[model samples]
Target: MSFERLNQINDYRQLGNTNLYVSPFCLGTMSFGTDWGWGADRAESYRMFSLYVERGGNFIDTANHYTNGTSETFLGEFIGNLRDRLIVGTHYSVFTQRGDANSSEDRLRKMVQSLETSLRRLRTDYIDIYWIHHWVFGTPIEDVMRVLDQVVRSGKILYVGVSNTPAWKIAQGNAIAQLRGWSPFIGVQVEYNLINRMAERDIIPMANDLQMGFVATSPLAGGILTGKYNQLALARQISVSEMLARIDCTTARASLNQEIGRLNLHNLAISLELMEIARQIDRSPAQVALNWLLQQSDITSTILGARTSQQLEENLGSVEFQLDMTQIADVDAINPTDSGMLYGDTVYSEVQDILLESARVVDLNH
Candidate 1:
């Protein structure tokens, strides 16, 4: 699709700060290369990129080690001179095997230098948001913050975001930065889905309190909530083994399977439920999953990853409609995450148990 066609995908939402407007869904390019198997081929990647941009999706997420820098290389060519149109976030601190170590002081300088290299590869002078991909060893929190501040001040990076960091640790970093008068993180990125709500115990509340943006990655739980694999599983030709082999068996998938088995006698029952919900809402299962994330107060953007334009379009449908209170309640009743069920909130849990037991009884009879 051309840029004009892609711009028609305009769905915008306000971030914590009113000045920054972001699309409800941000495209994650971690699957741009073939490192972990299964990614967009070059043509497909270009199509997805163009379609996303045309659809008014300006935020893009990527990492240095994704598919061995194939992601960045592809993005460099993909974005071309239109880099200024996208709010790009590229990560680091995950892979360093090819480089040498540095002293404490040099480490901070080196980290900035590494980001500069990333900028070069990305064919951009500045990154809208720079994320510390993962926590690394031997790097002090203070050093990391100090260098990050320097980069922002230098205009190499406009804002700093942290991904895969503990809630308490992130809180500590921000607190230190605040007390010492340094730039604190404006946003956080983490794995969140209906099945994996562990982050809610602390991350959600903390982010809300601090007014930090929360970006949910893997909102579909590694395609489990997409209803694709479940559809295949129903035929008995494609087992969970096939899914594991294809998608690396994410925590989301494991939890989904366990929960589905615990809830219904057969997994197809849950897929049928999702499919029914999708039909009722006039959206796809993937869209319903993404929409669920958008319903949260603290959730700023959902990072959607797809290896094809078709997949991207499917996920984008999530931004189409707001779920009614009844629909939201129905979904919550089935998938109770830790945060959704507070100590006194036992109504939904009780309902889930009754329904599960009833289904089990019926299955036994059959």
Candidate 2:
């Protein structure tokens, strides 16, 4: 599709009055290289990156630890001088070594230096957004925020976000920053999808209360919701000997649960339903899933990874169309929220009925 054909998808919202404009979907570069076991090569990665930019996508997400830095390397090469057009986010503090000690204050500085190395690899002078990849045991939150503030002040990173940090810790860190008159985190990155709604337990409500931007990663549950796998059919079709030769326990189970559970819930087959939905909407299932996320309130973006240009293209169609209430509720029924918690006050009060009273339906109209 041509760039002109692509909608601008201006689903922008203020991140606590930060004056930052962002789309509701962010392109994830985790599959830029094969270091994490499966990904595209340099050529394919470039193609996907170009396609994403051509589709009016400005935000890009990656990690220093993804593909042993190859993801950043590809992004660096791909972005070139057009870096100003990109709101790139990369992370640190993930478990790099099984037995090594976690990052300390100095270690966090080293990590930021390593991020500079990533900047070199990315061929950019500064990162648009930087993330605390995860909370390690040794680094204090105060120390981490101090470094983040320093980097932001130095113009090394335009915005800072935290990933996988607890709600209370984020609250405390922001409170400290507020008290000290320092820059607090403007965004949060976390695993949020139909299956992994765990962040809704605390993170979503906290972000809502603080007016922080929330970017959801792993929205597909690692391809489970794509309706691409068929464990039952594969098991039935393959002979015992052939199955033994080629069967994968992990992939098969992942496929089976998504397929069977979807069928059981919908009273229809998974692939058929997905294909039907795609046919009716002239979109791919990946697009539908991404649109489901993009339609939610308080969401800044949904990060996506594509090993091929085709996958990226299919996923980008999500921006072209949207899901209505009936469609969203169908998917939501398959993946219900943990509606038991009261979000704003962090109380365990039942607020579903009251909240639903004001719940607006998602659609093209609004």
Candidate 3:
């Protein structure tokens, strides 16, 4: 592929098939408060916000329950006069209020309450995108699409998205919406990063096939991909490095050590690779990680979280350059994306030939 990367921040991409265009990096507001006991103060939060906006970032991400709502409050003050220029997104996923557990009506009430609370905190009349943060097993997907469609018609939310949800459910929900004339989900958000390519197996592909944009959250894999962390994985047992010192890379062993989480050798190896490549490219590891996610064809945007102005600056600088296919191949070699069961590309392709048994078949694709 040609290796010239357009200047990001100002480089806006459409959110799925929607007309609304947003920056490649969606500034996540989860770190915009001290209410969480460990985040940027008000002054620092404003600095980061201003820094991101000055760089031409137009999308800001938030949630109603983030830091018990302090995140939305601070973001509201920061976004005072520039409300119309930015695409504001907020979430309502956690069950926070007392409501009847009977049916979709009660659930809708809770959802609406959460949305209004977020709006009041955000100081916005209408949210650009209202994301149903996740799919709970209790509430039916049909109810969610209907309620979201109602709100969209009422001008409370311009578009609705699904985040932290399964591919099948999102497919089912969007299909239901399309068939019933309700507003289909235009986008999806999921935890995706270099260390965790699990989404590539299903979520990203599903979103792409459905014409829905995929937003990658935790693009740094909870900071493990930053290449500057050494904190041990906490448990009564040994640290991940120590536990992984045994060097059993078998599938069963890997699954058994899943409790050690993302700090395993393979993931850390990915981090080391990023560091090496960044050294060669003269970019920060954080920037390398972000740029890798940005280059993925299926990703619509990547949510970038920063607690300091320095971090924001470094991250914004990532878009000014591009990684060649060789670097991308090196990164992919660390962990080949599992294509899951019976994938013709990654697994058995001969099944088709066996089934056809030398018979000529016309290939008609929709």
Per lDDT, the best of the predicted structures is 3
lDDT of 1 by residue, 1-366 (tens): 001111123556555543566776888998787666667778888898898898788888997768778898899999987776777888864533322444222256557666877888898888888887655434568877887888889988888888776777788889988887878888888878765676777777888888888888878766667777666655666665564345434543355455444222233445557767888867887777677677765678889888778888877776667777677777665656544543113233443343233232123334
By lDDT, the better pick of 1 and 2 is 1
lDDT of candidate 1 at residue 318, scale 0 to 100: 66
Stretches off by above 4 angstroms in model 2 are 1-16, 96-106, 231-283, 339-366
Cα lDDT of model 3 by residue, 93-173, tens digit:
454323323222215767888889989999989999988875554456788789989999999999988776668878898
Higher-lDDT candidate of 1 and 3: 3
Candidates' TM-scores?
A: 0.78, 0.78, 0.82
The total number of steric clashes, by the backbone 3 Å criterion, in model 2 comes to: 2
User: Where does candidate 1 clash, by residue pair?
Assistant: 6-54, 6-55, 7-54, 9-55
Give the C-alpha lDDT of model 2.
Answer: 0.68
lDDT of 3: 0.76
Worst 10 residues of 3 by lDDT: 342-351
TM-score of 3: 0.82
- Which candidate leads the pack in TM-score? 3
Mark the regions of model 3 whose C-alpha exceeds 4 Å error after superposition: 1-4, 96-106, 230-260, 341-366
- For each candidate, the alpha-carbon lDDT, in order, equals 0.70, 0.68, 0.76
TM-score of candidate 2 versus the correct structure, residues matched by position: 0.78
Root mean square deviation (Cα) for candidate 1: 11.6
